[model samples]
Target chain A: MSTWSMALRQSDYYWTLYRRTWKGSVFSSFLTPLLYVLAMGVLLGGFVEADPSRLEGAPSYLAFVAPGLLAAQTMQTAVFETTYPVLSATKWQRVYFGMNATPLRALDIANAALGFVLLRLVLIAIVFVAVLAPFGVFVSVPAAIGALLVSILVGAAIGMPVYAYAVGVPNESSFSLIFRLGVIPQFLFSGAFFPISNLSPALEWLARLTPLYQGVDLTRMLSLGTWHTGPALVHLAYLLVLLVVFHRVAVRRLAKRLAF
Target chain B: MISARGLRKSFQQKGQEPFEAVRGIDVEVRRGEAFGFLGPNGAGKSSTMRMIAAVSPVSGGSLRILGLDPATDGSQIRGRIGVCPQEDSLDTELTVAENLYVYGRYFGIGRAEVRRRAAAQLEFVQLTERGGAKVEDLSGGMKRRLTIARSMINDPEMVLLDEPTTGLDPQARHVLWDRLFRLKQQGVTLVITTHYMDEAEQLCDRLVVMDKGLIVAEGSPASLIAEYSTREVAEVRFGIGENESSAGAVESAVGRRAERVEVLPDRLLIYAADGEAAVAAVHDAGLQPVATLVRRSSLEDVFLRLTGRTLVD
Candidate 1:
């Protein structure tokens, strides 16, 4: 088999597995984001005034937070998918070993897993957009589509590194530490809830450096029609670099764990 | 077919010396024959099997499977061979049939072909009735059977089984052995690794006895037994500490007939051509044991004679 064919064949294992258990994740992947929009945007927005300048060109608090949450949702999906499921395949269920025993190489397994995560992120982004369309969160159909694509890119950028880290983790005890130290902080401070400028100078610089923040900013700009070419390219380049570098690391580490 | 010369595998641990799992062993497996690696746990059987399976890189020396170098052509070799690892790495999320289907797909088989082969394999393993059941719902034996069936889904020319029937009841083991026997009869090359001497004798046409990362002896079971052990073994059990003290007396009692006497924790095994005569002589020497039994020598005796340790522990 060709490399792409082998990868698709291996990913078909994940696709078959996901078909049986995808319903169980609907609450977390879909409902949790919608609830965040409801609680943080609509109910909480009523108490705050609509300040477009401070909200980074958004018309209301709901408009400001919803698009950023879309980006954050992508990050969350990517993070959640990469951590436990990656570990389960490598260590618990040993499905990666099973795949490695076949014609599929270790790189094929890694690519297929990351590809599945990307697919899930895209699906979740599309559904999140469709679910929030009536709320007028998206300013234009083309911009919304652009935001969706950027969300997936941002997810893969974050997910790939986590995939690299997860393959070598000894057990599940370390996953909570990733969420507590890495994911939760990124979600809270990465321009999702508010602009990073609200923080102190040092923390602002730190937030600006995070891929999640870049993703949030890019996703917000695209959704609200405030995108700037130079800054957009910078954000896109940052995410692309992280994605490429970590994809190499993840594939190598996966080979070490499964093929050795 | 598989061939190796000075094959070695070692694992490097942090802040520690590297542990050598396979210490320069040579092996050759012919096509359409059942070959076995018999050893206790940590004897490097699985490591060697992994090398043959092409999932693990050779730490040193030369190795080849299906006439292709594993380092470069692992995917090609894996495509033509099947592996049932020691652990049942079956997909718990998919149904029994779906597990087979997914594994077959990993070989790049088309969906219709995979479905057809999956049905045939499930039927072969006598799991046709439970095709739609969740894998977790199956018993251990059934799970192993499913794993074996999954291995055969691609119609591989060679199948590698690592401890194929460990942790199974007698009836379950017999059923698995019967299935493997059928596979052997079908002219598929079989490579099996097992600690069970009976399993080795029952299924393997030729086997190597491995211990402490080296192959100590290799031959057909009967030939190895004839070369390394006597025809019969007289087992005499005494109360705990009494067995060790009685070894000398038992050996002397059997005289020239006893080739060797192995004193285990709870019993004394006297290797002799005539076990009944050996047992009678033990009684004649006024050494009475709690239990006395005479049985034909087996591969277990050959292992005990070679390693000074039992095969299972």
Candidate 2:
């Protein structure tokens, strides 16, 4: 078998396992994220989101904020997929050690794990987009698909670096920091609830530097059917570089930890 | 199928002196032969096993598994060998059969083929009826047996079992031994390590006795016992605190009757070809305060004779 095939075989273990365990979290993935979108975008948007100064020329506040929530939810799903489960695979349950005992190299196992994480990202992003579709969140179907794809890239760009860090310092205490300090702040400040225009110049610059803000920028353009090719390309390039560099880091760290 | 020359492994912890787990030990495991490492804890038996399995890098010396250099061809060598680590590292998330099938896929086995081997291995380990059971539901012995079955999923040519029966009951140990013996009969090489001399004697065709990062002795179980220990031993135990306090008197009384004598905390062992005569000589010397039993020598005796200590601390 080819190396990719070998990696896929390694990932097959997770797929089979997830099939048996996914039921417990099915509602959280769809209903919970959807509820957050409806409550924050529809119910809360009617009173304050109608102000034109902050809506960024979008038709409605729900349209303006729906794409940002999609990006934030993607980031949450990505970090969730990479940290605790990956640590268990290496340090606790020792599934990665079990796999390394076979013909698979540490690189193959890392790649397989990354592949499984991305698959989960795709499934979750699709559900998030589906929840927003009934409320006229999309100007065009293809553009909505483009936003979903870009949001996945955004999740991965952030997820890979977090995964790299998690594999090395494998303790439960660090996870609270990721969620409280890292994820929740980005979800709130990085144009998810309001445009960067609403933030002061310093905070907007800081938000632009992070992955979720770039994701929101590119996805907002796609959702409104207003393609700003120049800025969109920058967002795309920023995300691609983040994914590549962080993926390399994650692989190196995991290999160092797993192999002698 | 496995050879090593002056193999060594040393770990360097920050702010501490480097600890040498295996200090330049040499070993050779022939095809279909049961080779054993009998040693106490911290004697580097598991470190040596990791080096042979290609999971750990060698700090010094040359090593080859199936004629492949682990430095360059670790994955290639790992593909053909199986390791049952000292800890039961079975995946508890999957069912017993699912664990077998999933582990087989790590060897790049096809789905249908892995399924077939998983079923066969379950039967081989006598867990066929519990295939659908979750791994956590099985008893400790069953979990151990399932681990053994997982190791065989790749149908490896050589299998390394580190302390395969350390915490197991006698019946569980015997059952696992039966499965291992069947593997040997099918022409599969087995490498095992344990402190249990009886286990070494029963499982090893040839073995090495290691202590404090060195191989103190190496031979077939019978030859090592014959070379290092007497044919029989007279074990005498005194009442209460008398065993330790009466060491000098017992040594002088029965010392010359036997070839060698060892004083332990609880008992005094007099080694000789004729143990009954040694006991009678002890009685004639007016040292008749306790109980005595004479038994044939075992690897435990050889270990005690060579190392000047009992096998079980």
Highest lDDT, which number? 1
TM-score of chain A in every predicted structure: 0.96, 0.95
Model 2 share of native interface contacts: 0.72
DockQ of 1: 0.84
RMSD, candidate 1, Å: 1.3
Kindly report which residue stretches of model 2 are placed more than 4 angstroms away from their true locations once superposed. none
**Model 1 lDDT tens row, B1-313:** 8999999999999999999999999999999999999999999999999999999999998998999999999999999999999998887878999899989999999999999999999999999999999998999999999999999988999999999999888999999999999999999999999999999999999999999999999999999999999999999999879999988888899999888899999899999999999999999999889999999999999999899999888
Q: What is the C-alpha DockQ of each candidate?
A: 0.84, 0.70
Model 1, residue B256: distance off in Å is 1.2
Output the number of the TM-score-best candidate.
1
B23-115 in candidate 2: lDDT tens per residue? 999898999999999988888999998888888889999999999999889899998999898877777878999999888888878889999
Query: Where does model 2 sit among the CAPRI classes?
Result: medium
